[model samples]
Target: MTSRSEILREKMEELIAVGALAPGQHLDETELAARFGVSRTPIRETLIQLASMGLVVMRPRRGALVAELGPHQLVEMFEVMSELEATCSRLAARRMTPADHVRLLAAHLACREARDASDPDAYYYKNEAFHEAIYAGSHNQFLLEQTRNLYRRLRPYRRLQLRVRDRVGASYEEHDGLVQAILAGDGDRAEQLTRSHVMIQGQRFADLMASLPQLAAGELLAPGAAGRTRREGAPAP
Candidate 1:
């Protein structure tokens, strides 16, 4: 079971991910502690945890703020993620066991269900499981660990991407192709398909930017704007 700190951290992360906690917004410990009905200790611990995940920025005197990635950084991270996923797919094609194939198919089915339901949040978790199955199928412990770490860091952004119009359907189609390639033991095809599926460049990147305002408005808004407050350079929450 998750502890209160973990739960609070996840809630804060969701707020940031959806833009409820805007970029550069300071995290006031007192407010957060009051909001969550907890003491400042758990809030502080949660902030530290989020900082390590790249979702929170902790400055010398600025305390904690939501981390924001510039356009260049976003592209660079996506590029690395694409390549890592491609490598995993390639190795998985060659090394995956029959049981691994079964699990991958199950994960894909779960994603399809979530997509059909038009549930982005559900699809996001299912998507994570799908990719994780591929990582495990790669049969390389070090590579799996690295991929999982990066995947976690990229989770919020990736989840936002799925909110793009038609993205869920398109992603499901891509997963279908990737699953087939890996199952058929076609490493080259699997690598190419996985890379294309994940690389958010060209038209895809443009589309993401176009959709940002909508995502920020629809998903990121707090109950009342006035209820959301931040202090610059405040003490650690």
Candidate 2:
């Protein structure tokens, strides 16, 4: 069952990821309470929850502000994430069961369906699942937990990647290749593909950086922008 606190937390995370709440924006408890039609108690709890997610920074006496790990810090985190997920892909190639192979292919197809619909938001959710399938297939509980933690920390940054031109289609293509390599039990190829898929550079990195100013100037969000913030298959906020 969904609780009010959980919904509020998800809403706040969505807003932060979609750029509706800019980096370093102050989160006033009373205002958030009014905004969600809840008491300040849940609002405080939600902010604390987001803090744990690396989405909010709570100050001792002054409430909270959105966490602002700038581009450099984010890049550093991506470097770690790249290595971890690459290891997962490599292990998955060797250790994955037949069931794991089936799940991975199913996730790939789901990504294609989302791409065909031209739904970037839908693609985003499926994309997470696609990567998670590989993580689960790795059969290493400790590594899986570490990878997922970093991935959760970087969720807001992925919203930037999804906006890059042709990225969703390009990402699907990358996933196709990765899936092939893994299913063929090519551990080296799977590791290499996973690294490239997670780490951005050259033109794609430039596109992501360029999108930021546009996001700040209020240009990148399309009509019905709230949908980007909602969880997949949930009603639009």
Candidate 3:
């Protein structure tokens, strides 16, 4: 794929994350090309990459569609994400440079602005910068890469969680303590705080559930998922 496809892929990812391209929605390459002012070639390439990421599905005769992710599957991903981020936090506590500390604090304070405004979308973007500073501070390239991939993949749900009533303020409070723990170089506390901060469980899970717009249980479970994949092949000759 070319650089054009790469950019398109990210844009499409955002549409899916925001529910503009709802789960199980059909993706029409010809129409998409016209809408995005690009050729079908790049659109096809973008869909192929998204399919590999499990964010889309390619059907043998039916073109492509968005993949569905059920709540259970989403929770499983969040569980793993929490563990990875906790590890990053642990390492960051011991490894962050003074400059890294500066950036981290800057990002954290930026979240406060969004919190004061009570804008979940604004907080979501700022929160990403804050978490990313910690990820980079981990000083482990492999760990950083893995943590980021999962972070990117689970972003939609994380964004959704922030929309719960008063969640923006609570998340800011969580970050306040987490930033303190990391800044103090308290690895154990930082790790514990990250686990608590990122994991969706109990009341937090309920909050996420409540935040979801009404949809069928099965769809919620595996919304627009590629449960019916059948690889394309030429008809028998």
lDDT of 1 by residue, 96-162 (tens): 9999999899999999999999987667768878888899899998888888767756655686788
Which rank order by lDDT, best down to worst?
2, 1, 3
Between candidates 1 and 3, which one is better according to lDDT?
A: 1
Worst 10 residues of 1 by lDDT: 228-237
- Per-residue error (Å), model 1, residue 236: 27
Q: Which candidate is the best by lDDT?
A: 2
- Which residue pairs come into collision in candidate 2? none
- TM per candidate: 0.84, 0.87, 0.87
Residue 14 in candidate 1, Cα distance off native in Å: 3.8
User: What clash count does candidate 3 reach?
Assistant: 7
> Candidate 2 residues 1-237, lDDT tens each?
877777777778777766676677789999888877899998988888889878889999987988877667867888899999999999999999999999889889999999999988778878888888899999999998889877867775776788777999999999999999999999999999999989867777777777666554435355665444455532122
Q: Which stretches of candidate 2 lie over 4 Å from their true place?
A: 1-4, 215-237
* True-structure lDDT of candidate 3: 0.79
Inter-residue clash pairs, candidate 3: 67-224, 68-223, 68-224, 68-225, 70-220, 70-221, 70-222
Candidate 1's TM-score: 0.84
